[model samples]
Target: MTLTIEELRAGVPKHSRKMITQNVVEVLNQLSSDHGEDFAEHYKQNLMSMSTVLKSGTYNMKDYMNAVKFSAFRLMDHSDVDSYMLAFPERYQRLMLKYADYGDEQSIRADKISSFVTAYKKNEIVAKVTEQALIPSRILNAPMFQTALNIQMSIAMSSRSDQVRSQAAESVMKYTMSPEVQKIELEVGVKGQDEIMALRTEMHRLASQQQGTIMSGTNTSLEIAEQVILHEIEDHDDIDISGELG
Candidate 1:
């Protein structure tokens, strides 16, 4: 039932109001099937309209800009986003080749990262990661864990680790220290950062003595698809009580 303003506007032209309502009903049913009744009700209550008050050009940049500003604000002032690309050049190159249809680089990068993070926040990421766990090769090879690997490598080798950590700690020292954990916290404001930081610290503290191989490279298309499958499976389980498995 929920959609972006642009999506809502697009749907309005293609479908009638009643059709929309029915469609929303079906969607809510499906959501309920996956997320439980409580979540379904919550989502229905929060269903949003796509209409917006625009100032001149179309396509409201409010939310998009907010995300960008948030990322920029939390990120090191002089930190190079390109560094991620440099560290994992092949992954970026492959993405450029695969996503050629999307001409905007920044848009592509933002979409890619946001999609991953959003799914992670929704608990979809865990399913996906678990699914990856199912893939025997990924668990054994390590390279299959591209996104996580990249983040791990970036943090392990970051020149601004101390600087980044200091700023991040100021924003959230009580949480944890893992980048994956910290990145999400930065989105929810300062307090969230602390919580994530504390989580990160705990993660490392527990793993400190363990010398397991860490994923340390960029993500690949196959890896992305794998994660998506995992997300779907997790979502499927979350909404369907009968679908739960051991």
Candidate 2:
């Protein structure tokens, strides 16, 4: 049985995803050569929007044709991005820059750990971090410390968060994100407990539902591949347009 990240990952085996990605790229370039660079770029960009890989967020297989998946996969296996960078820097420049930006963002996140800093002052970072956390905890006034933790999870390097914060985030994620876990809120009186429990359940359920709804909109990378490949074959007929194009 293949370890699954999400539903769309079912058809493709885990190991071959990269080779498929490289094939996709090769086909993309070939299409470009056959058609015109203009057509190629438009085709690639359309696929890219489908492949949309965000620099922030927990590494999940959400987007289509996202090279970031390969980048993350490569890093997890080798614990380094150097080989990936050197092997196909131009082809995977987005992932390279993304990995690089992760480091840069980590530095920024680490520096803003001070209590004096406000999430409002750093809105972009805070927003990205919150989205990455995948926790829709309501905050009438989100304090710096909480948002700081969110930021750490969003873009910080694995080592950036000390053991305590790491454990806290892990615990939160483990309980909050798990389907088996009861998301009841702890309260004092029986009435309060019941109300809070109901509310927490609703919120947690809604968050999960919202997440599922979002994921459903995602088109598989192969969808893009099919459209591009078909356009290339039917429209260009493998004819070289490198001269007229460039």
Candidate 3:
């Protein structure tokens, strides 16, 4: 299922909610430095204020604003942004369906593991680490670490709390299994797991160094942020348009 703008509004806080004009403008203004104040300001003043900008209605207030937010976020880390966008009600409903598919995969994996475990319990001496392939082969193959990292990175940036950051790291280790599976993933054209992990660690280190830095905004520590975001774009080949764009 796909998400619509109206549903996105439902997920955002009420106080944070403003007229369509304000919210869209503010998001554009926030992105001004990267995209150019002139580009954002021009779109805000001319195109966005129009009555026929969205299909939902003639005076498309909320829905138009939602579309803008969706499109704008897509130009950032699109995959990550898409995941967050799924929090909207329409997307959330669709997510429930996807969850069923995941449940099926888990059930199959679990059944295989149960058989393996039962066999192992009967003859412990004969069991090898290879015998427990179902768990790591199935569940661990998912992008569990990437998902946790996304949550933790958002929390760390927004909260600026070390405790939250630590919890995020712990959550990654908890959900993601051993480095053994990471090797398999890398071998399957997933790119460098070690590099990604190191990249996250170093980004965290730089963030910690800049005690007064804000999250969800421009990275003021130029050199480090440039390196990190560039590498991120390279690995993901997604929405990040740092050096490659300009």
Which residue pairs show backbone clashes in model 3?
none
Q: Tens digits of per-residue lDDT for model 2 on 147-180?
A: 4433433321123223333344354345445444
Query: For this target, which candidate reaches the highest lDDT against the unseen true structure?
Result: 3
Model 2 misplaced regions, further than 4 Å: 1-66, 69-72, 86-174, 177-196, 199-246
TM-score of each: 0.19, 0.19, 0.27
Please name the candidate that would achieve the greatest TM-score relative to the true structure.
3
For residue 36, what is the lDDT in candidate 1? 66
Stronger candidate by TM-score (2 vs 3): 3
lDDT of 1: 0.35
- Which digits, one per residue and each the tens of the lDDT, describe model 3 over residues 163-203? 55445545654554455532121223345556656756765
Q: Which residue ranges in model 3 land beyond 4 Å of their true spot?
A: 1-126, 136-141, 173-186, 192-195, 203-246
lDDT of 1 by residue, 110-179 (tens): 7664453444324432222223222333224433343343344334222233333233333332322344
In angstroms, the error of model 3 at 44 is 61
TM-score of 1: 0.19
User: Model 3 Cα displacement at 58 (Å)?
Assistant: 74
